[model samples]
Target: MSAIRSATVSDLEPLSQLLDDYRRFYAQPSDPAAARAFLAQRLGAADSRLLVHAGQAGALSGFVQLYPVLSTVSLAPRWLLNDLYVHPEARGRGIGRALMQAAATLAREHGVPRLTLSTQTHNKAAQALYESLGWQRNDAFHGYTLTLD
Candidate 1:
């Protein structure tokens, strides 16, 4: 049976490989070293919460990363899910859903009233998966992001 738990610094290597594959799946350049450094910062600095699913010698089968944020008006804590990836070879094995379920549990434990995430407009497969997992479209809101150069 696979188990999910909070990710620590030691899981960086496997988590890095998974992140690299995830980015490549969406057409990003493959760079395992960059992935390693990025994961290192996230885990080392304690700026984000990353959960991993592993079994037998700690193979990272899947992962989800969340960034804690706050609501502007009420100042209530919320969690933004930044990344959710399941290794392609592990697809159809329910690892993705397991990660999400664990994420929700984490949010609850942290006293977060809600969890939020965004996906590319063209990613119908991921949207479907999210909807099936109880996420809904926010027709009343638009998401805008600014990139720093």
Candidate 2:
């Protein structure tokens, strides 16, 4: 089934739900309303691009969101694959790979020099998929996070 496409405002509901599920996967509390508003804000600002995967029966099974970034050394634009989520039911069907490829294509078309993403270290499945798609794991630099609140 043709399942992937650039998401539009028409996909807001499903996209919001999927995003909330993604947050929950990271141990965040469920907040569907917050998810909706967040996505709406992002879409309205045009600061990011979201691609959706509509599985069987037009269900919104997965999505990937990209944000633009710049490589200081290269002095070229790049893409940060900020979020990627495929519903549990949609796993193992190559949707994730397809979405990654689509994101790469979009970046390349826009003259982006590279695309980058970071997944939880424990997410072996995602690592495998990314490695299989030629994504090199960054072993050179340590990643750090700081909580603002």
Prediction RMSDs, each to the true structure: 1.3, 1.0
For candidate 2, report its TM-score.
0.96
lDDT of all the models against the reference? 0.90, 0.91
lDDT of 2 by residue, 27-91 (tens): 99999999999999998999998999987688799999999988888988889999999999878
Tell how far residue 142 is off in model 1, in angstroms: 1.3
Top-TM-score candidate index: 2
Clashing pairs in 1: none
Question: Hey, what RMSD does candidate 1 come out at?
Answer: 1.3
Which ranges of candidate 2 are over 4 A from the true structure? Answer: none
What value of lDDT does candidate 1 attain over all alpha carbons?
0.90
Estimate, for each residue in 75-146, the C-alpha lDDT of model 1 and write its tens digit.
799899989999888888888888998999999998998899999999887888889999989999888889
TM-score list, all predictions? 0.93, 0.96
